[model samples]
Target chain A: MIELEGLTKHFGAKVAVDHLSFTVRPGVVTGFLGPNGAGKSTTMRMMLDLDNPTSGTVRIDGRHYRDLAEPLKYIGALLEASKAMHGGRSAYNNLLCLAQSNRIPASRVREVLDLVGLTAVARKKSKGFSLGMNQRLGIASALLGDPEILMFDEPVNGLDPEGIHWIRNLMKQLAAEGRTIFVSSHLMSEMALTADHLIVIGQGKLLADTSMADFIQENSRSYVRMRSPQRERVLDVLRAEGLAAVEAGSGVLEIDGATAEQIGELAARHQITLHELSAQRASLEEAFMQMTAASVEYHAHAAGEHKVPAKAPPGAPGAPGAPDQPGQPGQPAVQWGRSYEERRRRRSSRKGA
Target chain B: MASVPAVLQSEWTKVRTVSSTVWTLVSALVVTVAMSAGISALMKATFDELSELEQATFDPTFVSFSGMILGQLAMVVFGVLVVGTEYSSGMIRTSLAAVPQRATFLFSKMAVATALALAVGMVTSFLAFFAGQALLGEHRTTLGADNVLRAVIGGGLYMGLIALFSMGVATMLRSSILSLGILVPFFFLVSQILISVPKAKTVAQYFPDQAGSKIMQVVPDALGSDVAPYGPWGGLGIMCAWVAAALLGGYLVLKKRDA
Candidate 1:
């Protein structure tokens, strides 16, 4: 277990991590979420005693990381990639060096190489390996001592889909084995599937700490998408039926609160032929944006309207749906709790563009 | 203490695993031995022209120390590779992470480097001394007579000390390029150039390389009175002092500074 109490890190006048406190317990993958320059790396560095904390303490397994007899056996960390002295030495030799330091058995080098699927290339110099291959080697080095607490900063930064999937599963499996696996990443959708717990941060401050399921269920809302040959007819029926609905596209009306069953029966009774009907729960990414919209420090032009919806409180998971238009009937005037599904769809569509 | 042994093993791995380490050590041995033998042979062929006193003072031990001038360059390379590589590659964080006992780690590195240098120095010095003497035949100096062994052994000790000295500079500079910039001229060119200046010779002899090189002399030169504060042993002592100061400074920096 890693417990950080009132941890704060200040680089000269700039507070990189500001009075942040949280516990990364064993048996779960706690995703450390933040935007670029959000101090995620700084916090991780402090946790391992790499960077001194200006205020507060981070204890690993009840003792400071530096105070431990053998730190690698207690908490293994991968703060940077391809950091094991380059390709000058073979991959096996690199791990062997670390093994000697941590008093790990020499044979474990081969085990970790095999574990990360680098055994085939273990004899090769790391310099010749691709970025993804290097990342796996870094991971293998981290697992050298089989420590119970593992912290990885942006471990999936340069991985392919297959490698990313491998890491996500590895994290989950490690957590299942009762290791405290904390990983940081910018992609919220990936975090949704990989992280059991989320620690969202923005501008170097902790925004939220909650279970992923609860965060999604409580903070995210569900919405229904609808389309009809007679768009106007569907719009009138939705308004008369007191269903909050808005025109999403030329003939599509996005409906909320009413289920597909109710919408289908109502459209059928009105003799309106429905062309499309789909219900979407808020995605973790939208909930993240909704929670962090205002706190985002750097907004890329590509981030687009995906800015945290105006309604969701900073760190609050659920907010009401953001209006498709400036003013839609179902959409609340207050921009909060945008459904996660709508956020995902918006991001996906944006990407598709 | 066992932990210290483990640390030493780890540091050994660090040095040997890098091809640069192997290349630098090999280069040091090669350049130092080859140059010493070559210089000794050239000087020996002209031995008949030398005064008895000149010949008496010419300890073959001093001859063996020749490679050190060149070998020290390799020593500097080795020292810098061990410490500066971490800074250049940003691997110090990983190193410190694996061994959070910062001072122990540094000490272990120093111990490993010193031991390796001493062992290699002893072999190189003995061979250079023996080979140079063999080549001189009638003029050949033997370890059987005079203070020959002292100079020969001192050559090895001098090499070991200078290697540690380089390690100190590496710690202070923390960058291979900068350390090389500072070490090369001070040990190779600057001290010699400075001492050549009539009045400045007094101060130039106090340089680490000049002081350390005193170990090569069997007789104190007249220059010792005006240039060096002590005899050859004193010069080695001064160099050792510089190393101690550098190592202490490095330890403090490693202890207090963030990786």
Candidate 2:
């Protein structure tokens, strides 16, 4: 189990990680979802005490990483691929060093080598290993201590399809054994398939913390794509009913916050949308984008501009600044950390423009 | 602590497995012995007929210079491999994470470096001593003489100290290239230049390389001159102080740094 309370880290004036708080429980895979530069790596580093947090604390199994008697025995973390082993050393020797430090028997080195399927290359130098092979070596190093808590940052970044499937199953298997597995990734599609729970962050602030099912159910809004001879006419009618719609290019209007039943009823009343009116369920990607679009910090272009678009669609209960319960004081809105365009597209009225 | 032994074994594996480790150690041994032998043989054949006092006062500076120069080169690399290798390869993170007790990791590396350097230094000193003596025939003094034994053995101690001293610099600089860049020239060129400068010459005599070189001196210089603060042990002590200071600085930075 891992718990973080008010975890914050500031790199000079820019806040790399805001006052973020979340718990990772055992028996499940908690996917840490965030766009690039969303403080995922910084949070993980602070969690492992690799980087000092400016104003918060992170506990693993109810104890700080530094206070643990045997740190490796308590938390097995693969921070980066290159942190695994020296390239010139053989795989066995690398594990041997760690095993020696933690007082594990030397035989365990071979066991992990075999477990990672690198036994054939055990004595050979790791300098020539591929990215996938290096990742496996890193996993072997992490599993060497057999700690109940595991943390990996972007484990499947450069993996092949087969390697991806193998790791996905491995994470689930590790979780099934009641180990707390916290993995970070930028891809919502991968998390949808792998995560039992999701903690979404954008621009260094918590955007959503919920189970996968709840996240998908609560934030999943339906959209309708309309193609008709009179596109602007249908858009104007939908707009009059206060429905949100945007032209998705190629004369297709994507209407949001309205289902097919209401759309068909309105279309029948207006004598329109006879050509096409297809309903589109919001994907995890869209829900993720909607939840975090306002809080993203670093954009590809901007350096220090922290601007959250004001017109982000009303999201589920945990949308920025929303309180946890009715009539309760809501948390202050997170300080925006990115440029205006990267945060939101403002696609509310494309056809008019 | 039993962990100390484990750490040593682990570090030994780290030092031996890498090609740099083998090359550096080999360079130290080969350069020291081969250079000493070649220089001694050339000096003996060339300067065969000198006065007894001239021969007696003759510092093995020429023969010792071979191995010292080579040993210094190898020791620089050896010192670098001990600390700088971890930074280059990023193995220090794994090493530190394993042994979270920071001082233990630093001390263990020092122990490994000390033992390996001592063994190599002793062998190279013995070979250089015997080879130089053999090449000089009647002109060369035997190890059985009073100061001869101390000088011969002192050669070994000097090499080891130089190795440790280099390792200390490596820790401070934190890069093999930077450590070597600063260390090699300082030992070979800068110290010489500093010693030749009339104003700085007195202080330069106490600098690490020059002061440490006193250990290999069998006889005092004929000119009545003020001597360095300490003789053989004092020179080695100066170098030792440097090693301790470097290691301490490195340990403190490493303990506090983000790595």
Which number leads on lDDT? 1
* lDDT for each residue of candidate 1 in A1-353, tens digit (9 for 90 to 100): 88988999888998899889899989999999987778999999998888999999998888887787667788888877866455677888878877898788999999999999998999898889898998998898889989999989899888898998899899989999989999998767678778889999887889999998887777667667778888878867877887777544445566777988899999999999988876655545566766776666664342223222333232332323232233234444423334333555664553344
Could you tally the backbone clashes for each prediction?
17, 2
Tens-digit lDDT track of model 2 for B1-259: 2267777777777777778877877788888888888887776776656566655566554354456765677877787777887888777766766676777777788778878887888888888888887886655777777677787787777888788887777777778889889888888788878877878878888777777777777666411223566777777778677777777887777777666
iRMSD of prediction 2:
2.5
What is the docking quality class of candidate 2? acceptable
**Top DockQ hit:** 2
lDDT of 1: 0.77
lDDT of each: 0.77, 0.75
* Model 2 bad stretches (over 4 Å): A239-242, A268-270, A300-353, B48-56, B60-62, B221-226
Write model 1 residue lDDT over B6-119, tens digit each, in one string.
778988987888888778877888888888888878777776777777665555557655667777788777877778887886678877888888888888999998889888
Tell the DockQ for candidate 2.
0.48
RMSD of each: 6.6, 7.0
